[model samples]
Target: MTAPSAIEVQDLVKTYAVRGRPPVRALDGVSFDAPSGAVLGLLGPNGAGKSTTLKILTTLTRPDAGSARVAGVDVVARPAEVRRRIGYVAQRPVTDPMDTGRENLVLAGRLQGLGARAARARADELLERFDLGAAADRLVRTYSGGMARKLDVAVGLAHRPEVLFLDEPTTGLDPHARAEMWAEIERMTHEERMTVVLTTHYLEEADRLAAHLVIVDHGRVVAGGAPSDLKDALRGDTVVVEVADDGATARAGEVASRVTGLREVTTDGRTVRARTSASSAVVLPALLAALDAADVGVASATLARPSLDDVYLSITGRAFEAGAAAETEEVAA
Candidate 1:
């Protein structure tokens, strides 16, 4: 049997109006389906409608045109039901600074309609599981960034929601904390059997954690598939060969074109990057033979299987890390 969709969005649109200005469209004709018990990585740069999409799914905001359903509940017609079934962790901080970690989680549960006793019980369990038992009594303002973020996640899970929305969950975390959060997310998804929809500007994070991905750009999806499949779509492997100068670069391109089963040869004065089906059997050996025959000295050569980052660059014309940088600017402004 096929798995059911945890979240389904069709022709979603969100437009914001400002004084003395044309309305700004956040999400325009967006559509996708996420399977139950799967992690769908909704990736895009800043202002790419990622946050807008999450807001619609979590019932924080309503779409202007299209319909969205989370856990089989229509977002517009039954937003309350959708909210109850889905847990939302925003990209920004939402916990109260005056409240302790445990107190914050308990309050969130109560707000979600859990009884006092049940809320406290769930809070304790999550605090212990998230490795926050020792600091559960600490005030949120006094807690470290990582601890506070963990508490926010704990609050989202307090209601035992069926689908979770984590918007840039590790955005402000340090390396160690980020890794810990990733592991925690993986563990919780497995243990609770909940579907997760996460948005992130970090390609490495998406590559490592997501089982499937949908790459969005400027309010539209450009690519969607498993990471391996997307990477394989770039063709066999990438070979980066460094040569002497512009002349060597041109010669290398000519050589790569002559080499069988190779295409998309891009040169940058001293570096030549190309895609080839037979990296081991055909491309590499042919390039080496050509270089030798042309008397063009090769500084170095390296072959790497295509990565998710490569796919992003291929579709967007910019590096993934560059998009992260742009997102920083957007957030700051």
Candidate 2:
């Protein structure tokens, strides 16, 4: 039998009015599912409606149309119920700097409806579990970035919420800290049996941590599936050759198109892209020799199996970095 859905969303549409400007639609008919005890990655570039979707599901922002249910509780009709069943960890730190690590967890537990004794017990439990037992009594302001992030995650779990919303959880962390958070997320899903809904801009993070992926762009889901399946759907190896000059791009594309195994040949600025059913080794020498014969100077060339970025590019008609840069100047209002 199929696993039950921990969260359900359908055609979620949200629009915000901007003063002296036209209203912006942050979400446009977005929908996806997260199975119970699974990690769902919501991936998109900036202003792609990821944050807006999170706000609606967490009951922080209501959608003008469509429906969402968290842990089987309707976000619109029964927001409080949904809140009780889910833990929301925002992009920024929400812990009190003046409070000790243990104190913050205890307070969060109490707020989640635990008794005083129960709250303290949960705090100690989390401190040990999160490897914060050594610094449990230290002020949060005194802790390192990684330690503070771990504490925030602990506080989110103090109430043993059935579903957790992690929004850019490792955005500012170093590689080590990011890996630590990834492990914690895995523990939450496997050992603790909680469903996680993750929203992140880090392609590597989404590729690594999520059991399933739902990619949203321009306020809509463009692709949804397991990461491996999504990559496999693209077929063949990707060959990218960066020419020495932009002038060589068109010539490079034409040259690559004439190669025996290359297909879907396209040019982007100075790079010529193609896919080959054969291994790169089988075609790289021939491709290069042809480019050299045509006097097209090669800057560099790389062959990689289809990556999440490739899948994203095929579906979105642009590179992830390029798309991400598009919304940097505009707020997702």
Largest TM-score belongs to which candidate? 2
lDDT of 1: 0.83
Candidate 2: which stretches are off by over 4 Å?
245-251, 266-270, 277-279, 329-333
Give the clashing pairs for model 2.
none
TM-scores for every predicted model = 0.85, 0.94
Which residue runs does candidate 1 get wrong by more than 4 Å?
18-22, 240-262, 265-273, 277-301, 324-333
- The sequence of per-residue lDDT tens digits that candidate 2 reaches over residues 127-176 is 99989999999999999999999898888898999999998899889999
Cα misplacement distance, residue 179 of candidate 2 (Å): 1.3
Candidate RMSDs in order: 3.6, 1.9
Cα-based lDDT for every prediction: 0.83, 0.90
Clashes by residue pair, model 1? none
